[model samples]
Target: MEFKWSVPLIILVLVNCDLYSTIGGSTLKNCYLCNTYEPSEPESRSYSSESSELVGILVLKIVHLTLNPNQPSQATAAKIRSCCGGPVSDHFQSDQFEKMFSNRSSLEVEDHEIENKGFLDYQSFITASAFYQPYGFGTTYINQDFFGTKEVAAFLAHVATKISCGNKVVTREQLSRDLCYNKEMNSDLSYCDEHYKNTYPCAPGVAYYDRGALPIYWNYNYGEAGKDLKVDLLNHPEYIEQNATLAFQVAIWRWMTPIKEHQPSAHEVFIGTWTPTKSDNLAKRVSGFGATMNVLYGDLICGHGDNESMKNIISHYLYYLDLMGIDREEAGPHEVLSCAKQVAFNPSISSSP
Candidate 1:
């Protein structure tokens, strides 16, 4: 999906323009440049000729920036390509994907209660993944022998675990219940944090409950994701549930993005892109699948001494690795797979990303 320019960038431009006009010239009139232009409104056309020219120049610059972002140098692009491995679709086939979620997608399952049956498909996942492939979503190479297949498995494992309706029991039958729900069930909570009232205010009557493949929650998360994805999720968070590709896209985005500045993203942690600091080492937050969990869940799942929630997520990862024909041993030792000793990167008391 096409994304509009970020709100912050636009706001910065407007603020700069306002400052410039206040200092020397007549200010621009309130006019919508991106949306429908009001030529008939007196306020829209009331700006001085000099201000009008300035506004016109600013608008052109904004449009140009939006359409023609600066491209990386050839050397940088080549280096990125070398590290990103190959296309995910080339490594992961559609049939294998369908097989991985056969019970969830099949009508024959005895107790299947999928909210959106057959909605989550391989094509949608591939399409969503394609958008992030350039950024090394599932294509980061760890070494000459090992490519990004393991990272792909790790990401999908999180997606499967979040969206799945399967119980905590690790059985073949229970595993079949994966991908059963598109959104959180029976949630009345709007998940609007008062802390971000000015930055990401809760929309009137809109609920930012858990939704999408990886299930993002809260107004700040929705607002941030909306800004990154350019989807207006603050007002219409339901768009995630409505669009399968978008849902996967949002999930992948969550995986690729860091919750806080100076913190490692799940992708970075999983693929060894992020080096652990002395603090992280003291916290027992090493780089691996365990660190990925630490990055995503913090103390909720980590540093809890083998919690069921943490184990369940790990089980899903192993299960997906097996389904994808990768050895479970590649996931590393128990310490690398489990985050039972890692401290929270960002505690729950603070605003969660």
Candidate 2:
């Protein structure tokens, strides 16, 4: 399918509302999907701009996965950096954070002792780069074979549509429109927005803003990761487990760390306008499926034995989570393993122990 990659169709239906009306709720300001106006009580609700932006980055990574999954390892973060840039600090050169926090010779790292310190620091810096690079107006290239599967390409197209619309309100459209488009260079040429100067680059034409008209089909493709994630399922099931535990640890760390409170809320920074209240919902829903998929995929890749009983049980639990409307990306590895063992193993959680 060929996407036009043009301006999106945004439907903002606004009806007048009186603040004092109790019998009738205030006139609906924006379509729920379009998000044209403020909710009646904005304070009670929180939004996550960073999440939406991250979604875009994820989409890009998915595309790279289709082109060459291996390239996405660091390319995903690099694209984000190209589009956004990096943080600035008088005490440190924030752009070179990867090297800064890297485990290298003769380096005295300040935050080295933290749990999964390497991953968290890397993620934090990469995320920062994603937030800043979009405004850079230069072509962000990934390794030539960055895409891994067709599913990944389709995902990027889906996210492109989503970002074009106002689903999460990260707004890449405005940047695209305002910037001077140089196709050969794949760069935007525009002065940064004064208000966003300290952090985000303001590439007016090149930036994206409205994420409303994103098709429902994008959500439909959430299963690709599961389908493709089979390689890890069979062979390196442990990795799936590790990925889940790590994600859980990251979530826990975010909750416990004082730094999270000090940093701008995801919504405050980028586009997703609602607070992420359902992370646990995601954690719970994806636990079983991710592990199962990883094991299955691994088996597929490694030419292993077929276990019908294990498959049936894993499918049953995965179907249960599907009914709840959680996506595969949200599925963690540990949950997947536990669910697999529940069905795959009769007495013990492990095959032998």
Candidate 3:
């Protein structure tokens, strides 16, 4: 017969989930009573539902599945908790990419004119951007469409700041906060570690100054990234500066990999998978955009009170959010957006890998 829920309660439940999760497509496999739906199960896909009411939901799922059989049901259902808004297919496109790095051509001119120099052409850039999917970069914590977008933007903000040849703080307020390059200009340091020379020997004449999107500086970092990406970066650290895709890959790889075995990756920190320990709380490290800076930059960006460099990175993130048409308000409170008071998770230099 009929469900017992009141109209207002039903409305609340319906609005809470993505429309597709309710009376939309075949996102309702559990309601597939007459079919074999076992094989469609995603081993990694966990359910996000914890509804107090079930009767109305079941009816809605059945009605929706019966109505639309080919609406990418299983995929949508699996990502129920994704970044919440925007079309996933339209999340990060080439046009939007150009907007993020409009000065790519000029930046390249300042550096050197090479073919398809680092993120200038959208076609190659998009193709190479897929390296993060398998590493659990965008889909790890929450699966909102905007999650990927925001991650991309925040990451690119760091890249843009590091690679930028123009003024650091433009008149535009948002441009004021981009994360800078790991490489300090005019530094003669080779970043070669004698300790890892046996395991990851530095290539002769191949000085491992900071390179890549986020700029992996140390010989150890180059060796580790090379092993993970199947690229011999210790010897060929220039590959990052030469190829746009590889540069993005190195950065995304760093974001995905943790600083230490027990530490959380920048991705985890940004996506809320990282729960702060008592030490972390004492250090004021909580999950959000702010923790990402701590994860990536450590003492370089965090711990110092109201540091301009840290604020610059935060501004870049907010600018990118605005460019993506997302409200900067979603980034949470000031502490979560700035790690000024938090203790560094791992110091920039560590004895361990």
Candidate 4:
């Protein structure tokens, strides 16, 4: 997407020159001199006109920096430097966000019997992203060039699939009906694991079925996410449903963090930062979108030979890539996008100890 400074934003900078001078520091060095200078008592009376002219010149300089993409203001550069992939606003704007989830937010969709209907919105997702952008939640650059658009699409694909309530179809329109549900429906299971009782005990009344954008299940999962986010989800797992920002934040945290020690995170696998070991290769796992599924869901939705669940996820990803103006072909061949034959990174327990 082309980056253009809006007139309102430019006018805001001009009006708040003092704020800019404080934050921009060396970048707006002369701005402070032009705006803050004062002469002795006798000369101060005569300095008004000259100071006003100097301030006008400073405004012109600031306007030039704002309008010229080649020369970003210091404040803008600082904001961009905070993210590994750069600011998401630069690549994914509000219009694209609306297009992606417009169906989910429609009145007809909201009328359906779904838990937390109409709960997921663009603002919540974008606001939550600010926290993890520094850790490359969406911003992942390969070189001087930005390569995070695909990565963002891949991550959102997972989110959309997990939370979607659309029909089980592989078409683009069907896949765009995402953000349908924030929490799992009609689930009575507590999903509490006894293994982590000592480390992460389940609360008496709370049931950790599935909640949040990616739907974190099990007591241990909630415990870990709560601890990291400092939200106390073990006691109040329902918090994920009540807060949209927290829901998306938990999802992004899961995407960026490794499930176990000495393991690759979903982010690492998808962005090609992870190298497959001898075991990973033997298990048919490679660093790509496929390995990301292996890293996150393991054998649950993988190693099942073209299963419906896995296919649905891949469809969402490819559809999102197209919607974001990224070619689906860039997602690679079927092998790089499928985890059908891959072994689970963390297999489910078949036999009790």
Identify the candidate with maximal TM-score: 1
Q: Over the stretch 1-353, how does candidate 1's per-residue lDDT look in tens digits? A: 32333445443644443322221011111111112112221122222322212222223223322322344465555444224433466688877787667777667655544578667777678766654554566756544345468887888778777777656646856665677778988888989889999999999999999988888999998987787766789999998888887888788878877887787788878877688899888888888899888887777778889988888888877887888898889999998999998888986644334
Give one digit per residue, the lDDT tens place, for model 2 in 223-307. 1111222222222222322342222222221111111222222111112121323542443322223322322222221112234
List the candidates ranked by lDDT, beginning with the highest.
1, 4, 3, 2
Cα lDDT, model 1, residue 231: 71
Structural similarity to truth (TM-score) of each candidate:
0.75, 0.16, 0.68, 0.74
Off by over 4 Å in 3: 1-89, 107-121, 139-146, 173-187, 347-353
Minimal lDDT window, size 10, model 3: 23-32
Model-by-model lDDT, in order? 0.68, 0.23, 0.59, 0.68
Runs in model 1 lying further than 4 Å from the true structure: 1-82, 108-113, 348-353
Q: Write the per-residue lDDT of candidate 4 for residues 1-353, one digit (tens) a residue.
A: 22334445435644543332221112111210111122122111111321212222223333323322243355665444222533455578767877777677666663467656567766567666654544565666543345578877888888888888767865656766778887878888888898999999989978988888887889988987887766789999988888777888788878877877778888888877677899988988887898888888887877889998898888878877877898788888887899999998888834111
Off by over 4 Å in 2: 1-95, 99-117, 121-265, 268-353
Tell me which of candidates 1 and 3 scores higher on lDDT. 1
**Comparing 1 and 2 by TM-score, which wins?**
1
Q: Which scores higher on lDDT, 3 or 4?
A: 4
> Where is the poorest 10-residue window by lDDT in model 2?
9-18
Model 4 lDDT, full chain set = 0.68
